[model samples]
Target: MPPRWPRTPDRNDPAFRRLEDFINFALHAAIYLAVNSGLWFFQLLNHPWDNLSIVSGVWLLGLVSHGCYVFILADYRRIEAAAQGNWQQELATELEEDATVTPDEAPSSPEQP
Candidate 1:
């Protein structure tokens, strides 16, 4: 029988949760890289490394502050739902497809009269 509830995300689906983690990581990395580059430019201009090092600290803090953990959790939750074979989720997917199904390709129902 089809599942009665929506499918939960499968945290095991490496593609799902992992992707979110990757995104979070990339975001943090980008922020860090930008800061580092700016600091490097300043150092080149004779600014002291002492002040520039602060950017690294801020970058580290931003990784946690940006809620990377939350995104990872959310991704895992989605994977769990999918693993549960949730019919509600299946139905929703089918409905979405139906909206796109061409009229000519759609099956007809009986007792139209």
Candidate 2:
């Protein structure tokens, strides 16, 4: 089954972003495997293509790079921590603004004429 997010999915969500990146990499790898396998199978039958190895090698490199990025380089924890920090800062700012509002300066209901 496809994954579903508990809340609205946004690019700013670290978990969602990480999941999306991984899913994309998985799709890429799957396509690479399907295509390269088919190419190899056909090459074994007729041996017509001369640059098949070069093509597969380059594609494998790309797949490896993608895997490295998704599995090793991407840091979800840091992203989540930074997002949390931003949220905390925003909440603190809002609380400070609310605390600074005096009763006289606060918005009141419209006075009836």
Highest-lDDT candidate:
2
lDDT of 1 at 8: 57
Number of clashes found in candidate 2: 0
Per-residue accuracy of model 2 over 1-113 as CA lDDT, tens digit each: 97678999877678899989988999999999999999999998987899999999999999999999999999776566567777566667768988986568668889999
Expressed as tens digits, the lDDT of each residue in 1-113 for candidate 1 is: 95342345554664556655666778777877887888788898986777566767776787766665655444454455566767478668768988986568566667755
Highest TM-score model number: 2
Q: What is the TM-score of each candidate against the true structure?
A: 0.39, 0.68
Candidate 2 lDDT score at position 37: 98
List residue ranges in candidate 2 displaced over 4 A. Answer: 85-113
TM-score of 1: 0.39
